[model samples]
Target: MVGTAADADELLRHVDERLPDVVVTDIRMPPDFTDEGLRAALQIRASHPTTGIMVLSQHVQRRYAVELIADNPSGVGYLLKQRIADVSTFCADLVRVADGGTVLDPEVVALMITRADRDHASGRRLTPRQQQVLALMAEGRSNAAIAERLSITEKAVVQHVSHIYDHLTLPPSTDDHRRVLAVLHHLSR
Candidate 1:
């Protein structure tokens, strides 16, 4: 449902009485649209550990996405509102959340990566190739697409991305998609 953090709390309190299994909230709402919806999502995760949550936002709030799913990713998802214009896709997002799958918006992910590039420390430390890969990845291109964009082989794109991740000291499981998010998080700051 759509509501503020306080409203969500109240709804949860009431629903806790009924034992619901899923919750969805917009990442911005009411009072101030500065990640309050994100706060509510986190609170739901904290108070109802088994409950699944899907947070929708106008933009990708990487910080909120990290906090919401970093500890326990199962049954958690984050999507941008712009990515869903039809009910079928929206319903699918909720289903994914209920099934413990992540559904991050590609645009949001790209935005986060671009934001990361702005970080003086990380940006300056990366090699030109690594930086270029990072930028292309943020554009939501797959390895092949990135390779085409950079006039390299897909395998080469993967290798360069691997180097980029290694230089950033990112974990192996940090999917290129999320690596972009992490980069964006750093850039945002």
Candidate 2:
């Protein structure tokens, strides 16, 4: 694998040249250490839609998650540095992103879900159970996982998800990440 500690400019250059299938970068990088990597990630995604990006940060930044996920949820991930402690899961998540799957840090998902449930008008329309389902969905949980967590049947999870889509006015989509984007859209508004 090609590796470098370069700034966004160099990173972009490499991406342009290599067109690697996956990129794992820290949110903060050289020359400013602010959001250079995040900016580069956005540019890389815009320029190379097929590329996968995983942004790792020391802390949870809601805005970072919002911007990266707002436009598209596929082939992207936002994880905290602590996640690497579970190397197997972290590596699996990276592969999942490279394979066109969305992987969100649980903390980031909680932040968005809480904001949506507590403040968003659309969230106000949802029942408490529906809100719970939405939170799991935002975490990139499948219907089966949500069901196991909530101690409900998968069929019930499906029904709750349907209600969430109806309340959010999101048309049904086959894409797995659609629910995540929908949740973020509600939070953003």
Candidate 3:
């Protein structure tokens, strides 16, 4: 079923009635035009356990991504509004979220990686090459993609990822969004 709300309160009210399988909302909506949608999304996540959330924004706001995926990365997705232009890909992402998968826009991931590289708590400890691999990982790239981007072998990419997890002190997580969360956790510091 599909429903619409003008503001965060209305959205919550709608959710209170019956949770939808997925929610696709813009980051800036209603009342304040600031983070109302993001705040509301978080509330929904806290209140409704089964619903999936996909937040869209014109700009890549790292904080939104971090907060949404902070506790549980599953059933969550954050994408730039432009992604909607490619209807097939956008719908596929939403479907992935509904299926308890996590999807993050590459731009958002890149932004987080860039910010983390500058001031993340453990970023300084990462070798520049490791940092690049982490950034590509944050972008949801496969080991193959990382290797192709860096002109390194897939085995090397795997090694870099292991080191990134080690340097960040991330206890191994099977969560699909672990890579993105690693970047988010760094930026959160």
Candidate 4:
């Protein structure tokens, strides 16, 4: 509600003038209409690390999602435009991003999981339940949230996370966010 811009350049200008808690932008913008918004979003991320970003796309461009979260997975999101129809969920996603949580549309998460399974042998080692847990993790869901969604206990979710880390060969980290980023990076490849 702070301000709006027509194109990527204007968007950057607005951001430079006054940074917002979260920025929601399209993956495409005016003029070239191809990734201009994403480029601007990257620039903003570089300059304003505290500000959150959410990139909306009409199509599920897995590459763009990967790119957006490549350097820093926190306070970022990539969602399909259709997600906007579910206003409550969309608002929740924005708030989550603003609070330094990564958010990926479920469809995007599914695509990444599918691609990972096809491309990486390690991905094939996971059970369907583990894959579901991993997908929720990639969507920035905490163990409690994942457990609620899966109708399981938090301990079960924790065990699944441990197994996922072992299967993916991720090193032990005190930070959960780093683990999520590592999993996402693995899937992106």
Candidate 5:
């Protein structure tokens, strides 16, 4: 909440003046109102790698979501405006993004899962439970968070994540973030 702007240009100027830990912007802004905000966000991400970005939009726009996280999924989020109804959760999501975690709206995760299910060309199918775990993973949930949400043990969540990696044919990585990125990349395909 360091600064606010009416349009993308002003937003960029404000960012230049004083970079904030996280930036929450709409997908559309003044002057054409057609992805100007997203463009500005991409510019900011390019210039300020440490700054987190969250795009709150009314529309689904899967392509836009994919583009935002294409190069770097860390510290990025794409959430629907409807998510603001839960103020605490929304605020938590902002904090997570600021701390270099990727967060996608539940609706976005649902759409991605639906699309992935529809296009079953990957040859490896995930179990229903695996799908649920993957959805939470895409939402940037840690193992403990996923376990709590699923009413399971953290070790069980870890097992599901490992199975997901095996099913998706992702190479084993010591970095948890890389595992999330690999899963996200698979879903986006």
Candidate 6:
């Protein structure tokens, strides 16, 4: 059972027919490249209560990670594809999933934990202005809107945002929406 979510309805038909042990899938797929694969996995697990589900992704998408493990944590596994490059390790993960063992990749685990600590530690490190800026950024506000909110110039907001990005070790990019994902990842723990 490996496919994108667009075909999941049809795939679920086949899965129902075949009754596979575990459904391993990526988190991105057609019909909107969101967490479609994860949703499909959940649907499969819901319809086929006995089936175990394992999800794979290149990065630790904490949002999907959280949902995938929402139920039957012991029977669900989330692994980074990089961690499964080795055939033996991948086989071991499959065996573990088949036997209802949660197989989280070490890197993903570390990232999830570290992000939690970072979110907890952030308040103590950021200044009041920085905190305001972060809240606005999390809200998908533009630098101009953030500046207006703080009664400052857009230039100042841009500078503050850059400082925030630098402090967070995030790449400097105009599309600040990525910070929302970063915050979600941090707060997810």
What's each prediction's clash count? 6, 0, 0, 0, 0, 0
TM-score of each: 0.60, 0.90, 0.81, 0.95, 0.93, 0.58
Clashing pairs in 1: 75-100, 112-184, 115-187, 116-183, 116-184, 116-187
**Model 4 per-residue lDDT tens digits across residues 1-189:** 789999999999999898899999998999999999999999999999999999999999889998988888889999999989999999999999999999999999999999989998888899999999999988888889999999999999999988888888787777665566556756688
Misplaced by over 4 Å in model 2 are 172-181
Tens-digit lDDT string for candidate 2 (1-189): 776757889999999998888999999999999999999999998999999999999999888988887788788999999998999999998898899778889888778767776876888888889978887776667899899999999999999988888888888567654576567777565
Error of 6 at 95 (Å): 0.9
By TM-score, who's the top model here? Answer: 4
For model 1, give the RMSD to the true fold. Answer: 5.5
The stretch of ten residues in a row with the least summed lDDT in candidate 5 is 176-185
lDDT of 5 by residue, 1-189 (tens): 899999999999999899899999999999999999999999999999999999999988877878888888899989999998999999999999999989898888888888877777542378888889888988888889899999999999889888887777777667655566655666677
For model 3 the TM-score comes to 0.81
Clashing pairs in 6: none
Better of 4 and 5 by lDDT: 4
Model 5 TM-score on a 0 to 1 scale:
0.93
lDDT of 3 by residue, 92-146 (tens): 8889889877788888776776777687558888898987887676555679978
lDDT of 6: 0.67
Where does candidate 4 have its weakest 10-residue lDDT segment? 176-185
- Which structure is stronger by TM-score: 3 or 6? 3
Per-residue lDDT for 164-189 in model 1, tens only?
77766676664445555444434445
lDDT of 6 by residue, 1-189 (tens): 443334556657767878888777777766676777787888887888677777889887766766765544556777788877898978877777777665666555555545655667754465668766765654335678678888999999877777766666677568654454444433454
TM-score of 6: 0.58
- Residue 19 alpha-carbon offset, candidate 4, angstroms: 0.9
The window of 10 residues in a row where model 2 has the poorest summed lDDT is: 172-181
Instruction: List where candidate 6 sits over 4 angstroms from the true fold.
Output: 1-6, 120-188
- How well does candidate 6 score on lDDT at residue 8? 54
Ranking by TM-score: 4, 5, 2, 3, 1, 6
Judged by lDDT relative to the true structure, which candidate is superior, 4 or 6?
A: 4
